[model samples]
Target: MVSDRSKGEVSNVEPTVCWVVALKSEAKPIISYFELDHQSGNNIFPIYRNDKLGHSLIISGVGQINAAAATTYLASESGAPPWAAWINLGIAGSMDGEIGKLYQGVKVINPTKEKVFFPGYRFSKIVSLAEIQTLDYPTPVKKNGVLHDMEASGFIDFATRFSCNELVFSFKVVSDNSEQDMKLIDKMVVNSLIGNRLQQLDALLDKIITLSKREKQRLQIPDEVEEVFKQFHFSVTMKNQLIQRLRKWKIQFPNRSISDLVKEAKTAADVIRNIDDALTDLKFDWT
Candidate 1:
């Protein structure tokens, strides 16, 4: 059944992670698992979102172009934060014997163009690793012991441009082996395969979310610091240094206002000196 076309509730908060998957069957597990709701106007391309889970998912139909376009749409429509993780999760044909096993994509290759993508810098302990080859159509041929899929290459190629390499990841569940017929697979079977691995997949999602949050905290520049920069006229280099020092200050004194430390300074030079003195006084030792 098509979703109700009425507008969903407006959220002041936005999701910090984006999930891209091909086919409605591939997306169903995530939508149910995450409790996502459809955003009304996005009927053109099915987009489901759950801000509380920090996830936004887009159904990209079943092609490389559709995958790429859907990912781009999720980023734009959901206001995907720069620090958010972009993941491509779907079913793939694998030569490996494990039909329900999940594997992290270490590398993605486009067989036709010879283009390659090395996505996600961090390694996962939860799932095994495998290479992926994206072809124009579903193929039983698993080149070089890697999984074969129809959309990962396009998704990864576009996703890497928007998010850092470390935050981009792909995980494929092996739905068919060389002996299994692709035509036999159905929604119930696909859903069951993903449903069986919920525990493991949830764990992987937790790790990815944790990493993304850490990156956000590190890269965020405090609004207070920005206000000061505007008033005092910090140079480009000085502004960068100020932001770094502000981050350290925040870590050391979580509740203290960094603005107070520089309030007494009459000039930009004094601001730097005061912060430097505070840095010298900080004790890094902890029990």
Candidate 2:
């Protein structure tokens, strides 16, 4: 159960999107695009935010561990709501993609840890999709059809824990490819790669923001449900069940009060049973 107090702690800023980038160069275009202000006093990781737009960002220096740690740090400092979207955006080496083409990482694999993570909804119309493999060190693209990066696997692995898989995304712009050499790429090159794709990035973000809002509504706990949580001693499992049932009940019978129906219930099980029984009774009546 999300108690009001806990909710208050995380709901203050109500950021709708959190971006995790591996380098300052990668973050530059996005920060400018979103008009996010640098949060002062945090040197461990450079954080930025625009409360009104519900956007927050963190620039992790480099590598998978840095990406993961920076993600966790941003989540903690930003206090982003659980429904907020998480995006890992940066440059990557591709086996065959165009030098500046952007692609969403449909599948992310961490070769070092032998972990695989599928992140984000398929926005087929907005951008191209590709497979991303995160490695410990920068290496030339040795395989075909895969985008090689150093941060996505770490970002996805940690970001999904803060939100859901559908809300966590990894987008990479091909900075170096077969024709382009990775060794020659510089900060200016990184900036240009990401900067050129801002328009497409905007389109993707608009869609994600829409989905995030819908998710926020679905996960919202009613005031009455909060009261029930305060009154009952629901275990973690029971709490989740109760919240799910309440959401369904609200949809089926929006005019009814779930709290009133469960007022006489003495325990957590009773609360769940009463709601289930009410839903069952309604179904039976309709038949």
TM-score of each: 0.82, 0.82
How would you encode candidate 1's per-residue C-alpha lDDT over 80-132 as one tens digit per residue? 87788998998889876478888888898997989998898555678888898
RMSD of each: 5.2, 6.1
In model 2, pairs of residues that clash are: none
Candidate 1: minimum summed lDDT over ten consecutive residues — where? 1-10
Q: Write the per-residue lDDT of candidate 2 for residues 145-254, one digit (tens) a residue.
A: 99999999988999999999999999999988888899989999899889999888887877898799889887777678888998889999998899888888887887
Off by over 4 Å in 2: 1-12, 227-245, 256-287
lDDT of the structure predicted as candidate 2: 0.87
Clashing pairs in 1: none
